[model samples]
Target: MTHSRRSLLAAGATGTLALTAGCLGFALGNEPLEFDSDRVAPADETVAETGYEERTVEERTMERTEEIGGVERDFEASIWLSNYSKSVDYMGQTREGSAFAAVSVPGMEVAGQSVNPLDEMSNEELLTEFLGRADSDRGDIENIQQGESFTLEILGESRDVDTFVGESELEGEPIDVEIKLTSFDHEDDLLVLFGVLSKRFAAESANVELLMESAEHPIDT
Candidate 1:
């Protein structure tokens, strides 16, 4: 894990303690439910039309054990992620830029504790956690500058998102990347959408937004 990721997680852990006290759904006898990775990804037609190829669709889980009453209890959260990429000509060379969406829901396992981690997190915190969990293979994100706030539609509902600019190494070259991140409650799930665009082409940023706007995994798929 990178230092940035560790720091974000540490901050979240402390915030969780204070937020859980007022969470109405905190460990309300709900069983943890696993979401289907296939359904969380954007539709095939959507990707094809957007000229992006699917890279990965998988469930990423985070497990933790907490000591309560001198006994150890285990808890876990399942995060469904769907990644996609597209090749573009940048400075006369073909380069691949990527984007992805990750979704997590309530009802995370709480063992004997009354605090549900997901329920305790706000949308901004959820976005931070999702960004922190980015794969190391994607290169380390650095010098993040938070940008504008805007509204976008996801799962048919309007959501507010914050934009950010960051630098990352892409194939031995430094590339400026734009990130649009948002987290919000939708129906029964906490939906987090993160779109990354390498500023190789002028249209790449718009493409990233299109990819995110088209994100969806049917419940039955």
Candidate 2:
């Protein structure tokens, strides 16, 4: 999200208050939360495709907040770059949330590397093959107790996800918020992008969608 200088000031004001509340012990963290299946459904169909067979680009900006360790942190604005090609498509998603931001490219591959390693495997196969190793390397998802924090989990080289949580105080009231980003590769027909940008900051989430829509490189039909 492109933010005027004025908007940054407003976001800072909101963040300052949240930080204060956190310091006062008004917020706390929760255990590793399970993914809410009802809140997020897998994307089963293509949303939009370019007619031309050449590379294309799109851009968007948004501002939002998330709950981390129970405290709310504000994101002023963010940018992203999505590029697509014939052999493979890459969507680079980024956001400046809280104390830090990250950039991720989910559909990347090397000459001998696999695209969708589990393409021929069932969900159970995929989980047993990929996640079993990951869980061994990274401890089981545990709850975080601090207020306003971030966590990044590398599910695999081809798939990874991150989440940020914070608490927001607006108009003398407290509100919980969370933002998450999850991306992974699929079969040749498509790629997968999953993430959440929520809170009173509407622009933060919009920026993410804007970047996806304004991908610079597109697949060649």
lDDT of 2 by residue, 95-123 (tens): 22211112222221112222223235432
Each candidate structure's TM-score, on Cα atoms with residue i matched to residue i, is 0.68, 0.22
The most accurate candidate by TM-score is 1
What is the clash count for each candidate, in the order shown?
1, 33
| Candidate lDDT values, in order | 0.58, 0.28
Which stretch of 10 consecutive residues in model 1 shows the poorest summed lDDT? 1-10
lDDT of 1 by residue, 5-116 (tens): 0111111333332223323232232322222222355567877877877776666666555543343434455556666777766568776666656565444323234324
Off by over 4 Å in 2: 1-95, 98-115, 118-189, 195-200, 216-221
